[model samples]
Target: MRKERKMDVDDEQVQVMDLEAQQKKTSESDLPKIQKKAKHPVILKFKDVVYKVKFPSQRKKFFKQTTSSPVRERVILNSISGVVYPGEMLAMLGPSGSGKTTLLTALGGRLGGNLKGSITYDGKPFSNQMKRNTGFVTQDDVLHAHLTVTETLVYTALLRLPNTFTKEQKIGVAEEVIIQMGLTRCKNSIIGGPLLRGVSGGERKRVSIAQEMLIDPSLLFLDEPTSGLDSTTAQRIVSVLWELAQGGRTVVMTIHQPSSRLFYMFHKVLLLSEGNSLYFGSGSHVMDYFESVGYVPSVPMNPADFLLDLANGVSPDESEDIVTVKEKLIVAYKNNIANELKADLREEENEEADHRKEANTEIEKWPTTWWQQYTVLLKRGLRERKHESFNILKIAQVLIVAFIVGLLWWQSKITHLQDQVGLLYFSTGFWGFFPLFDAIFAFPPERMVLAKERSSGMYRLSSYFFARMVSDLPVELILPTVYVIITYFMGGLKRNAASFLYYLFSLLLSIMVSQGLGLALGALVMDLKAATTLGSVLMLTFLLAGGFYVQNIPAFIKWIKYLSILNYNFKLLLGSQFKPGDTYPCDGDTKVCLVEDFPSVRSVGIRGQFVSAIVLVIMFVGYRLIAYFALTRIGVTRKSRTTKSWLLCLD
Candidate 1:
């Protein structure tokens, strides 16, 4: 029996080994196919690229009279040139004032200046195809702070991956990217900001990189990926980047001073100073180039540190003037390296013309359908903002305000017509301002995120706008509904179910109108302080013309009352609470009723209530349309003045 058991165990072990060997053989066979699929690598080539900004003429004060000087042109990048091939990482190293970022932006097709010269991907001009295949990581981490790492990437993948990919496939892609970027441990961690506690700096940076990698971009550009990390963490980040380059990505990053270990990881380095290229070559041969140019450092030092020192106009030989050293380096680069780069670029360009002809025929479309974008964006918006919308403090604020208002006017008599009218007006005005301020913050904080996503062509502007409005509607209306329920009963308004719903409906419509205006103002200004100030002034004007505060506004200014959302809201509220011919008790021996004749009540007559509602609905839609138009004009979409003007006329 023992012998038979031993034979069975040996057979099982042999079977397991055979299975392992087959699996290994399968993986090895698949490796070349994967590599071949990714072998259509993008090569970035730039030649004589120059960026300049024109400063307006300065006004001079002479004898108390102002005279303008001629406009001056400041060169941000002065004829910079370089090439980055696939499977290579290029680092742009410089001091504070150098044009490393400017050149990087130019190559990324994001620079907004008088940029001259050629920048091509795979010897083709920048096109939508190139844009789709390129990924850019900005310096500042522009992720939502409340979302978990996995949530962030998953939403990005859903919105960004092609519509051909199923939802499960997109999710699987996000998970694969997370694992590839080594973020599995912090996949569930929140990306925190100044006031929140969550992931570390290294994790946040990794999340940013992972976000770009979700699309498997062939070309990647990063602006200072290691800005604030410690040496070890920075090295780890660079190591990940090295692996990405090894996968046939052309990676270019503007780096601040890097540690020696980090420096060696880069395959190529471009050193710049004052908008001029100092050196551009293989990272390991930089010292050799400098030594050949007769500027070798006397002592061994970190290559990055030594390069930065030279770029900053510091000389290895103490006797050389800084200005002279800079001129010499620039001259040496122009004389020795520029011609060779140009010749290579010309040869490559000749070889790529046929390839470009074939590639140019391909058409690009949005990755997701409109409905798909809306659904994914809606889900993401709900998850990201649920915390802010339903936080304890915000809930408490609404409850406290409701309780206070309810107690202040608790169970007033029907005869108290003035008190009832005051309550109705207060409800209109409170909702008017409550949602305005809340909605004003919507677009300003999100401007960066919106710009980033739009640049990447993740979804349509209309889809995003509609999804944002739809997601905000429920969250924005809940508090006001609660406020009405508390104050309506305690304040002794009409107790009928229809009347209650009407009151609720009127206040909610008012909130929607005000929220639309807030969105418009926020999108228009896009500056928090400025938008808030403008909103305060606009709301105050509306309040004064709302018929309760100034019943008989001046004729020239009376037109504003029609424009005031609160005016229509106040009228609707009055119509909802009081019916025609309603009366209240009067102070007299005969008890003559005068509620119907009250000036404030008569001004906001109970009739034509539906007209007020129709107008409110129009304004609600109009304000949102204006906000959308403003966003399109301000880079949210391709600007079309004809479309904007036609829409405004229709509105």
Candidate 2:
């Protein structure tokens, strides 16, 4: 009786599992079908594509044992060749160091440095036109966490699509992509990740894909779209890619490990091991080819697992070692498929030169005008900052600090001249420190996002930097204004209205200069901890060089004061505060008297105010220019291809 009860319970569990599976199928079926479009065939062919790069000392340890040298040259990808036709989804399968992402970047036209290859689209050599018509979805999704799905895609479409598209047309395209990506249910939801509350991981991934789809490129490349997702979610993403391919767009993506069901969705598979192709053939024929080569799989084996295991040095032949099996497979692939690819490419090469020329000419033009990019980026910047940029905490911090400072220097009188000087110094330091730190934290997190957008040719670096700074000016003005209003009267400065306004303007200039320094520092270093440390050290040096700290210095080292932003600010403030033709009460022994009928204007006269303001303006523009150069150089890093994506993943 007990045995029968156990059997009945097992049967009940099986039935429940079947019911859940049925429900999942029903839910998926209820979603809208993907819209179809006319297919444009883009035949991508590469021959003897070799990528050789210098391995910095830090990265040399990851490769085979190398000699001790200052610089090392390593072949990342060796004599690789393959072809991916239109309407096909090619899956690049490999272990971590297999250079799958590198290959993808090379094909997508983002790779730099020493690359030797012949890559052609259609029958002509690859050109800028090919790049313009291609879209790349990185492994790490880089979206504004504060923006909703619809907002993010709208902005992307506006920047990426042609200028001929009307604003309403851009919006329509965004909505269509949203529905195509199956993100309609969460269209209005924010794309929050670790730092905020919003959409799920699956939704975020879809948003990234949706963003690239806005351009309607003939070719799309994705780097590990299924990584970090569950089996069910991974399968769903693959199914979406399959639907995309059905519409005539060529899709290529690097996949780490896909389930057996997901594996069959690919039209072709390119298996890479240590940067060399082990096999390049139809997805269905991969197993048959391996079996023909004597790597027979057990019944009902997961094909993806079997291939990954083989690439990772798992040998099926008991008599042969793992390395031997890999070599055998590589040799067999080259002998069978490599020559055929080259021969076929030769046949197609003479077909069309005029068409390629026309495409190249059309691709030379920017999709949108410069003014359009600036306005769109400006809007995006403002919207992204709405929630977190001016939070209660920042306002409270400024007010509390201002109140404390006001109390410390309560209604300071001219009789206490040293106290007044101290107040001036303190105010300069406060404005310089807070604005600098605020700007420092602001740019590093956005560095990755900027890199991703820049790589996609979304806008000019100058436009993005200008738009960001312009958007930030309003908030930058607020804190310094609040500090001045609260403390100016309490500190008891010159009572004239013109004098007060001059002082406020000087403080604003100083704050903006400080903010520029922060942006430069953050852009100089991609790592937060490193940037913070460097910024602190530089700030301390500037503080020492500021005039209030050390009045007289050796002539040789006196030049340091010029680099100190605070020194210039203080001079402007002091110059504007005192009248030129007034006598000051002085002690008999003192060279310069603090308590007097009228203060001396010898150190930096009224002229200093105008000169310093001009200098501050120059500094603001200078730092921003440096930041732009830094960002452009940082799109690719030593660590990985998805540097910006990794940055977005950080809180």
Candidate 3:
């Protein structure tokens, strides 16, 4: 056993060495050359960009205070200005709440507020074409945990790459990006989550970068790419970004305090404090700039650490007031570095006038067709969610419920009219709640991924909505079908082929309608706990009004039954089991009686079975439509109008 363990350890070590060598080679040679030939260089320039948000403020009165609060504006980015040219990586550094991320978002054309600014790409205003060619890497990696690195990238390529490229070509691009990002070693590993063990954190971050790199974007913006990483891993990530910039793509990233080695990788640095720019110039010149302004560091320290200290109002000279030092730095930057940056930006604008016009005139179009998007999304949804849908826990729950219902009403006789009716109602109520509670959790977790992809203009909201609906139908229905099959015969309901077929159809329709309600609730709320709570209330109401528990509902509130999915479903199930004039043996030596006269049977009459099915069908479609529209209202496509307004502002 000891020898075997040693052999396994040796194998792992060898793999690690091989991976390191491959990564080194790729970073040195492959990455820089990968996109150089196809690169479209962009110069990102922003001048006098100011962003402010409104918040409610309550004013206390000495005599009588009102409950209402007036609105007040707070500045987030105050006249911040900088420029980043192709082949340069600009790092924005500051402490928390310094508006580093806010500025980055503004430059990426994603910020919305009372934003006053001029942000241009290649001397042109923001446009749909510019959006297509830009990449924004968010701080939280929004990725599906079940997909492997290759699968994730390939699907992204298919969805986002232009349709002119053959499917095979798009796939090749994904593979090339995988190699360029040095992800070939873990190409087949899952992008795991908190509960699952998959790739290392460094590898996962690389995969996120690789997804954006597949398009060979001319401009890239990352919000704290090196956050939560060790010094070595952070250095490696910045190294990759440096190589990407070297390939002629302008890169801008917000980074927190970095080591000296990592700090020097930035070509230019922007130091911000309280929404004010303290310095904007070459990274190497930051120390000199600070010294010239009479704030030199007394001891050797990492530039990032020193800069952060100054931004936090920690003066190099402890005797000097920190607030005075910060004010002096801000004033000095406005007088010196800010003017130089504006001059450089003007010169570059004049130099690129013709190129800017041509770039702005380019037409905008989706990369893939609606049908293609639907198909790809459907396949991906199935692959990612199949395990959850068919896992042992879910299947066992359904089976257990089925067996319990069957045993409790085992071989119930038609003479026992009450027992038979009770079994039908229990089945109806079980399915009604089972599918609903399961479905309410669908969209909350996926909201992040949806927003990320939709912002990138990957696919249409309609395509994604329909794909989700279709993909869930087949897998979601299987257990319900199994449950019905188990309980139908064991409970001794009608034994004929026609009776069984009608019974199965009714149950299946109920499951689907219930599942649709779940999706609608999930999408509408987009909060797991809130949606679950709402679903519980709704399912309980439907169950109570389903014609079994309550026979004499008030006329004013009886209309709720029309809206209850369970009401229609119970009617269909009753019709399937008991028909008109069906006689059942009665107690006290009675010969026969009409089943319809019973309170349970009379409440849910056998009439209008066809109408009930039609109502269910409508509910299924109507609920999904509500979900899709709710998603639109929240964020999916609503941002397009915001993007247009942002573009107009740049113009």
TM-score per candidate, in order? 0.88, 0.88, 0.90
Best by TM-score: 3
Scored by CA lDDT, what does every candidate get? 0.82, 0.77, 0.83
Least well predicted 10-residue stretch by lDDT in candidate 2: 642-651
Higher-TM-score candidate among 2 and 3? 3
Query: Candidate 2 lDDT, tens digit per residue, 1-651?
Result: 445535544654564466446434633673344556634568888778887666445544565886766656666677778888778999999888887887888788777666787777775665656656788998988889999999999999999888779999999999998887889899999999786999988788889988888888788999999989998787777777776777788889999989766776788999888778888888867766787677865433667888987888786555677798789888887888878876765654335556566545646445788899999999999999976578899889889988998898998865556677677778888888888887888778987698788778788877788898888887799877988888888878787889889889988989989998888888888678998888888888888777666666578988887888887887777765665543333464355543323232233334556778888889878887787777767564223333332222121
Which residue runs of candidate 3 sit more than 4 Å off their true CA positions? Answer: 1-38, 58-65, 347-362, 634-651
Better of 1 and 3 by TM-score: 3
Query: By summed lDDT, which 10 consecutive residues of candidate 1 come out lowest?
Result: 642-651
Which regions of candidate 1 deviate over 4 angstroms? 1-39, 60-70, 347-356, 587-596, 633-651
List model 3 lDDT by residue over 1-651, tens digit each. 445535544654564466446446656753433445326889898989987766667687888858888777677788888889999999999888888887887788776657887788877777778888899998888899999999999999999899779999999999998888878888999999999988888888888888888888999999889878897787778878877887888999998888776666788999999889999988867877887787766665667888999998898767677798789889999898888887766645455676666765766568889999999999999999988888889888888989999999899989778898888888889989888987787788899899889888888999998898888886567887888889999999999999888888898898989999999999998889999999999989988888899999999999888989888988898889888888888775478888888888888788888899999999989998888888885443314343333332221
The window of 10 residues in a row where model 3 has the poorest summed lDDT is 642-651
- For candidate 3, what is the lDDT? 0.83
Error of 3 at 611 (Å): 2.9
